[model samples]
Target: MMPRRLILAGAVALGAAAAFAAFQPSPVAAREAVVYKNPQCGCCKGWATYLQRNGYKVTVIDVEDIEGIKRRLQVPDNLHSCHTAMIDGYVVEGHVPVEAIDKLLTKRPNFTGIASPGMPSGSPGMDGPKEDNVVKAFGPGGIRVFGTY
Candidate 1:
């Protein structure tokens, strides 16, 4: 039989490994994010860069009519932003935080998508100090607060 001390040490190591894994980003291959923005938008590029830093495999496509993509995605007019992204079959609008994105992916809520709404200051792509943002989930059911950051 294994020594009692060895058993205890092994258990501790296993627990530590599990906890570390939980904090790491989920499978990267599953986190492909496609961002669509107007050709002239630099803020949109900044937002995409932020997503890349947070473990998303980001692909950016510059289009002439950003509104066309928004409309095609069925994003609400009120929740519109400078850029839009699609990840795991969900639409992410604006400079939404990674925390909210994590929640959306984890919960898999039935909704059109989540949005920070408008070009809010301090959003991932925007300049200025970090500001509290009201993230909303909008769909056929209507809009509701998802989280605040």
Candidate 2:
């Protein structure tokens, strides 16, 4: 049989664990991403999949007028990509890396959004040997080189 002190100590420990668990915060919900892609663009689909794999709740819409969508999103001609995405009120164009996306969300800046510009080989969706990706931030104010990854 266990001693009284041992039993009392066990009970206290168990209670403390339960209390700690009860006060623990719940996990945050996944971020929502709405992707607009051309029906025949496979790379765009791959990008959506990449976002899902990285914890984004993605919704893909097949639109024939992808360029129209880009224009509506204020994506400059130079920043156009195969697919367009809206996340938390920011436009994400082309194959943007998860790290860049996270940084954009964490630091909400005054810009239309960020873009990887052209679909460079080896980007998140496109397949090839990894390349140094150039991501830029653009708005009416103009473009600023965001980073290179």
Candidate 3:
């Protein structure tokens, strides 16, 4: 027969494994983020910090010319931001909310990515209030109302 302590330890280990398995995020779920912005831009830094605070793993790249990056990526003029980022395969522009990006990744929507448009107030880097900003998602076609937050 097994010792009581050994039986308890085995039970605990099994329970812990079950919990970890149950709590694991889906493979397709989005978790990490990467931001590309001009090295001199303070707002871009603030935005990266914001993403970090919200449980995102952010990689920041200081670029010489954000416009060049934007043009190379083919981001539309109206969906422009001070900085541009690529997370997973989608292009995230401006101070887009992390939650929106989460949804986009989970759903794997048929679009390019989310854009807040021209550094609107209350965005990630641009601070004010959640209500003060309106972020939109864009695609090859045009802008679509993804969400306000």
Candidate 4:
């Protein structure tokens, strides 16, 4: 009778352990961002800092010819900005906010990338409040609203 009781107790403990393991949350993989900007661009640095603070592993690359990079990446002339970033196989242009980027990642939309067009004063990295800011997505489907900040 004693041996049977001990075996039962061990089995219960094992079951509990399995349950705990199953309920544990899986670790999330860190996302990597690579940003390209002009060598003397200050706003670009600010944008990179914003990304770092928002849980993205950011790598900023300073280049002398930003236009060449944009051309290589096929960024539209209308969506040109001071900086460009590559994250999770998406292109981010200009002073796009972190919130917009989050939405982009979550939706996983079919697009070449998203852009803020120009360096808006009230953007993530630029000076001023983030009011009336809009980010647009560009792809084979054409330009569409991505998010508003």
Candidate 5:
């Protein structure tokens, strides 16, 4: 017959293994995305490049008038930025981080989408060592805390 101590140790080991297995990294990959920007803005292009570097399949569309696109997508004025994107049925505006975008895709927020407002110096495409940058997530209703860095 097995000893009590041995049985207890085996049970603990099995429980730990199960926990580890449950917390294992997902094998699923991120989905592709599409971005829209003004045709004359080079910064928007840079932002698209940034997304591409970080494992996102980005499609860039340069439009003559961004407002038409914005109105079509119901993007609020406060959340407006240099560029806009759609990923997994959510809008991504301006220099929102790849991680935040990933979270948006994962959580699937029931709203307009995320935005960074104007061109903040430390934003994703506008990355710099400066601390003057601010990012905000917005919807048709109002704004939400996105991040500072």
Candidate 6:
């Protein structure tokens, strides 16, 4: 028969092993993004680079008619920007930052997508100092604040 001390030691070892397994972090899934932009747009490329840097698998499609793509996506005209991106069924427009994207993905709000409106300086890809980087979410419920950089 196993001694009491031996049984206690085995139990402790099993507890430690279980604890280690529980604490181990799980692998995160990589997100895929498809960006549609004008063929001649440089800032759009910059935005794609930003998303890639943030662990997003970016696929950029340069189209001659970006406005038509936005229209088909049902993005509000007021939220129009230089580029549009589709990620996990969400439409990301303009120069939106990564933090806003993270929040949008976490919250999983019932919105069509989020937009940063015009190309503001200091956004994810735009040049100049980043300031007042505000993003809005538009859907059947209308537009509302999404995030700020």
Q: Could you tell me the lDDT of residue 64 within candidate 3?
A: 95
**C-alpha lDDT score of every prediction, in listed order:** 0.92, 0.93, 0.84, 0.89, 0.79, 0.93
Per-residue error (Å), model 1, residue 115: 0.6
lDDT of 4: 0.89
In the predicted model 5, the residue pairs found to clash are none
Query: For every model shown, what is its TM-score relative to the native structure?
Result: 0.80, 0.83, 0.77, 0.81, 0.73, 0.82
Best by TM-score: 2
Question: What local lDDT score does residue 94 receive in model 3, on the 0 to 100 scale?
Answer: 89
What ranges in model 4 sit over 4 Å off? 1-26
Q: Write candidate 5's Cα lDDT for 1-149 as tens digits.
A: 99999999999999999999999986866567898999888888888888889988888888888888887887788778888888878888788878878777777766678777788776677756655445666665677776665
Query: How do all the candidates rank in terms of lDDT, highest first?
Result: 2, 6, 1, 4, 3, 5
TM-score of 3: 0.77
Error of 2 at 59 (Å): 0.3
Clashes of each: 0, 0, 0, 0, 0, 1
Q: Write the per-residue lDDT of candidate 2 for residues 34-135, one digit (tens) a residue.
A: 999999999999999999999999999999999999998999999888899999999999999989989999999888999998888999999999889999
Which is superior by lDDT, 4 or 5?
4
In the range 55-116, model 4's lDDT, one tens digit per residue, is 89999999999999898887899999999999899999998888888888899999989999
The residue pairs found clashing in candidate 2 are none
Once fitted onto the true fold, the runs of candidate 3 whose alpha carbons sit more than 4 angstroms away are 1-30, 129-131
Instruction: Return the TM-score for candidate 1, rounded to 2 decimals.
Output: 0.80
User: How many angstroms is residue 15 displaced in model 2 relative to the true structure, after the best TM-score fit?
Assistant: 11
| Residue pairs in candidate 1 whose N, alpha carbon or C atoms collide under 3 angstroms | none
Q: Report the Cα lDDT for candidate 3.
A: 0.84
Q: What is the C-alpha lDDT profile of model 1 across 23-135, one tens digit per residue?
A: 98756554899999988999999999999989889999999988999999999999998999999999999999999999999999999899998877888889988788999
User: Which residue ranges in model 2 land beyond 4 Å of their true spot?
Assistant: 1-25
